[model samples]
Target: MDIHEFLELPHRFRWGGVGGDDCMTFPASWALKCVGVDPAEDLRGTYRTREEAHAIVDNYGGELAFMDSHLAKIGAKRVQHPETGDIGLIKAMTGETAVDQIETQIGAIRFGPLWACIHPGGIRATPAEFVAVWRLTA
Candidate 1:
């Protein structure tokens, strides 16, 4: 599917099933699918909580490091600007406070201008001024 088609897809949040959409699953799935690549059957089930997800990145050093590692793993190249089909890595508050401190989440850029993310209600769009974009390479 093309970028336009991908954007037109209905957005929903599912923790472990890839039926329509989810934050962690959508960007990679859409990017891969756009190029005729079938993304993993299940990109869920491993990490179910914030702590578990954080641990996955912590194991690879930190957020940026984890992104770097994933880029290498997927053969994707980091780009300075947003393109139609590039995946965006973003940092935003998790809305929960820990010891009076706010936690942040790293999510993908499914689309831009108004970068979209999955939320409990549905897809949420945020400004792209602070997101990092990457282009997937075959």
Candidate 2:
């Protein structure tokens, strides 16, 4: 699938859980298509509630640590500026569970100037400065 098609895949999922159609898996949809690797493949279906998700994040020592450790092993390189097809992370002001102002970041994909992630209704371009991003290679 091309970038346009890849970006559209998240609409098919109902957003919820740690790995089903949540933050990690949403952008992961693009990685799976572009490089034949699913970033959240291991975590999918492993947790279903907010607390369980927090435990998983803790297991990896924090959210960015988990993303950095995982994305690197799969051929993605962290970049200062993300282009289209790059995986980006940003701090989200979601609510109380945010840790040290990190990982509340929903992993998203760069689509020109906007970063795409799963929203309540569907996929939408969210406006938040990326704290970190990973460039994918084929």
Give the TM-score of each candidate.
Answer: 0.72, 0.82
Best by lDDT: 2
Predicted candidate 1 versus true structure: per-residue lDDT over 1-138, tens digit per residue = 676676667777665434555455667676567554533343456656556666766987876676666555666778887766677777654443445445455556646476766656676667644446778766
Deviation from native of the Cα of residue 42 in model 2, angstroms:
1.4
Clashing pairs in 2: none
**After TM-score superposition, what is the CA distance of residue 126 in candidate 1 from its true location, in Å?**
1.5
Candidate 1: TM-score? 0.72
What does candidate 2's lDDT look like per residue over 1-138, in tens digits?
776887655464433334347776777767887898877778777777667767887899887897898788788998898888899887664533445334366678888888887755567786778989999988
Report how far residue 27 has shifted in candidate 2, in Å. Answer: 1.5
- Go through the candidates in order and give each one's C-alpha lDDT: 0.62, 0.74
Which regions of candidate 2 fall more than 4 Å away from where they truly are? 10-20, 95-103
Ten-residue region with minimum lDDT total, candidate 1? 34-43
Name model 1 segments beyond 4 Å from true.
16-22, 36-43, 96-103, 110-112
Task: Give lDDT: candidate 1, residue 131.
Answer: 48
Candidate 1 global lDDT: 0.62
